[model samples]
Target: MTPATSNGWLLETRGLTKRFGGLVAVDGLPLAVRPGEVRGLIGPNGSGKTTTVNLLSGLYRADAGEIELRGERIDRLRPHEVSARGVARTFQTPKVFGNMTVLENVLLPALAALDRGGHRPRSEILEHARGLLEVVTLDRQRHALAKELSGGQSMLLQIARGLMVRPIHLFLMDEPFAGVHPTIKDIIMETILRMNRAEGVTFLIVSHEMATLRRLCERVSVMHEGKLIAEGSFEEIANHAVVLEAYLGR
Candidate 1:
């Protein structure tokens, strides 16, 4: 895939800076994600990867910066407001409602964001939920309680739930493969690629798994000590001396 230029970016963050008390978490970060592009964010611990996601998702207000989703400024919006604007994200831990059935969890987003004329009938919503479950290969467990699912299954369900929002711009995924098994990890990765290709869902994935990130992302951004120190294709980041030292102590 070609790199997203400034003009065609679906999501753009300019001078995005965030701070917690005296500690700067994300410093003057600038990023652009194109429609349908899967960009990876990789950095060592305490590199502000999760902090950046929080800021973008409106969990934390930026001390400075601007975030635009499809050219609309959204940095100051509340989390739910951000969601309503077509931005969806999955946390590192599955955030599904534990007491809800798998299908119910998937349907919640759609129900919450129902607009005046766009609301579907109950039967149609159920069918749509089932289709989302099928996309994640979780239709077999659609009737099960969310809390009963394994870690990997819960992760897939989280992604499916995010899709229920019908996002058009971006999906911010935080450490999606952190604790998943290799087989399940492959399933999730493949599903992500398929979604990007089939539905034009842009992604900004944060992960420590270099191999997985390299395989899944066309471009990568490396953060360290609250700063975005590098941004380029995986090969460029992998070969950078600073990145090598950051990952492997000199």
Candidate 2:
């Protein structure tokens, strides 16, 4: 049995597997993310990187294996249940309430965080929501409709919403740099790093932008055919034979 120990790591998945009909989308995989660490997951298309994220976030149920977040079993819970446990995630395609104002979009989740019996007043919740917008540099856009924001602004809003929840421990972000302008990408990167450093939140980032991942993550895991084949620092994975072969198909 995998020992239940926090050990400063925020997440640990052992023998995680998922199958879609006859196809195995995720093979037996074991992965861990330490608190305040920015870990990257990378692979060719359909290598199960996103599937792992889905499973971790409770968007999809795993076929087998255990998922422990801070030493607690959470593999069988629903998405909201997972979120309530201090896990929040953003998708490859950002999902925001387009009909709502930017402040409201973020405020909803923050408000939900209060549903579990909190004594704070409503004004405090709204202030916290605005603070998250400030962190994402979107405080000026608070009253703007979500659909009025540009692509990069939309992505930032999604991230801010995830963080609006009080004490969000880990964020599983998928393709956060996708469709974002270069300058805005830097803003997003800075936001993530700053949040991790300042608040001690952990991150499991799944991104195709290799250069950005290299700059951000302390360690990276490479996957192929639904299995993690290589894991190391940026320099090590760049020159790894198997990783090169997986990318080069040699």
Candidate 3:
């Protein structure tokens, strides 16, 4: 268990650092996200937002710092282990199994969990998977091969798959709205909000869409050169001088 002070945070990191041959991709960073909060992480390209997500998701191991989820250290776990711990994430680019049907792609995670001791009935799991497809507006495409879908549709598939991982504690969404049509973007945003409000799911969303962040996030954190520069409500961070300088320059 973490110290009492950290109990309030669903996810927390301290002095988080990572480097690729001295590039210092993530440098001495600290982050905290409260339970059920939709928090936005924004920065210019190469600001370490995705790198941070990768570390937290265990795709890339950290060189320094610790990651705690509900007070247990998870930074050392493997990717599958992290997922088993109830951390799920979407990537900047949609990743799907081209050969698999859309419904099969969504079913993969839950089926994997069962292999690892999850006891949910197969019938119930299948029904839940179909329901998630409906939420993402992809129910009609359930029979199509994943590779046959458009880029936007592939993104929706990725989200449904991510949500299929049961017992999700925190969801790390990276650039979910990028290149998506406005209508599809609204659907994605609504799905996120619905899950957050109805399921009390926590999210750490990394996005560049300022307007969407303003609408979906209770608070936003700004990063520059691998370090956090500002954090506050959208209105507060929007007016922050340091944040402006980082994005617009002097």
Best of the candidates, lDDT: 3
- Model 2: how large is the Cα RMSD against the reference? 2.8
lDDT of 3 at 233: 91
RMSD to truth, every model: 2.4, 2.8, 2.2
Looking at model 3, which ten-residue stretch has the lowest summed lDDT? 1-10
* Candidate 1 backbone overlaps, count: 0
Which digits, one per residue and each the tens of the lDDT, describe model 1 over residues 1-250?
2234458888889999998889998999998877788999988899899999999899999999999887789999998788877778999878889999998899887777665345567777778789889988899999899999999899999988887665445789999898998988998899788878887788899998989988889999999878888999987887899988888876
Candidates in order have lDDT scores of 0.85, 0.87, 0.90
Off by over 4 Å in 2: 1-8, 115-120
List, residue by residue over 93-168, the lDDT tens digit for candidate 3: 9999999999999999889889988899999999999999999999998999999998878888988998887788
Q: How would you order the candidates by lDDT, starting with the best? A: 3, 2, 1
- Candidate 2: give the clashing pairs: none
Better of 1 and 3 by lDDT: 3
Q: Which whole-number lDDT from 0 to 100 does residue 249 have in model 2?
A: 94
